[model samples]
Target: MAEKAPKEMSFLDHLEELRWLLVRSTIAILVLASLSFFISDFIFEKILFGPKDPNFITYRFFCSISQSFGLEDVEICDAKMPFIIQNTSMGGQVSFLIWTCITAGFIIGFPYILWEVWKFISPALYAKEKKYAGAFVIVSSLLFFLGVLFGYFIITPLSVYFFGSFNASPEIVNEFNLESYTSMIKTSTIACGLLFELPIIIYFLTKMGLVSASFLRKYRKYALVIVLIVAAIITPPDVISQIIVTIPIMALYEISILISAVVGKKELMESTSK
Candidate 1:
């Protein structure tokens, strides 16, 4: 039996395909987020607000590290976050829950979302590249999750402790809104997750001839300034916390440089052979 000809996809056809991909990704996120409704108590009391407590694991670890270095009275160990999380609006609590669940859903469903995105882009790749679909999803997901953990465990804790406790004066007390608190967590986690995709982004940009390793190297100093600025922005105004956040990001940038170099090498080899 003869097979029918494959229909050539137009611009609108591609847009339609993207729309379906987004729908599937959204469903995946919502479904996973919905499951958190069963564990709302744990999510709010323990996981979401874990960084606010002095006894959180990140605090304890930093305390031990500080003590080991002979630094007296580590802030993380002794400091109590002197702030109250209150709801200002009538639906503030309800809205917070919804947003929290949605954020959690996106983070949890990240891998599935990556799968959908890869499906959309896979047709553009060569057969050899297509074989890397599994690796791409796994590595990208792992990096994202790692970034999320880093933000939650390190950056969030430090920021929470610093801002929650810091008083400009003895008169001004910190009364944090519920929405504001969740925004900090959501922004840090999501931002870090996206930032950690630097290497992957660089690899593809190199492949597409949009960027090269030389370009990255040329602007390494500028990237350093930008990284430091980002670290300072997301983290507390302390040198230590900023340094901790900056290290991983700088490492990712370096790794991106290496990835770009390898991709360029591969493309050059392929071209030379032809």
Candidate 2:
């Protein structure tokens, strides 16, 4: 006997399901955030402020690279970040702690959130596709975390180094607000995480017949320009930093094109067989 397909849901039912999904995801995030409060000091000191240190891992790695190539005069090999982070308002510290925990929670609970999203959409999938739920969640979560690490290690350090060292005049000292500093860190990590989803996004778009490998190839130049623009937006104004950011993103775009091609090929074969 064959298994029956899932019954179609009405609009109201779909909305109700989506509402519960949000509720569950929110609860998970809050729980994780609450747990994070216990380790707030560690997060602030080690994770958030790590990039600000001259001896940070990223800085050391780049310094080694510069030394290995005999580029002894590179600023990263010797310069220090000169900016200080200050909270301007009485409630600022309290607010920053709360938001930072929430951000941490979201990052930690990303897999659960993806699972909830998978559940919300699974009813519409065929049984074969539904069986791949574990793979979907795992792959998406892996990609997201990779993106986060890339942003934290590569983008954050470069931005901090560049902006902190830049001076219009020797008289002007760099004192970044606490909010501004944390915001930069958060934006860099989250943006890169989402940006790293390009291949997955292409897979879905190809499945829905909305995008094609040829389309991506045809617009390769435009995509490069867009990638450069996005890199510039995320990194500092320096050419080297911008180039560093652009490299991985362009690689992701190229991978997306390949993913789209593979998906299209599979769909074509399936269609012909049917």
The per-model lDDT (C-alpha) reads: 0.85, 0.89
The residue pairs found clashing in candidate 1 are: none
Tens digit of per-residue lDDT, candidate 1, span 1-274 = 2222345578998899999999999998889889977788898999888988878998787777667778666566686888999899999988888878888899999999999999888767776677889999999999999999988897788778878987999999899988899998889889889988989999999999999999999999998899788778755544666787788888998999999999999899888877
Tens digits of per-residue lDDT for model 2 on 1-274? 2233559899999999999999999999999999999999999999999999999998887767667767677777775888899999999999999999999999999999999999988887777888899999999999999999999999888888878888999999999999999999999999899889889899989999999999999999998998788777655544665677788888999999999999999889888877
CA deviation > 4 Å runs, candidate 2: 1-4, 229-244
- The stretch of ten residues in a row with the least summed lDDT in candidate 1 is 1-10
Write down the lDDT that model 1 would get: 0.85
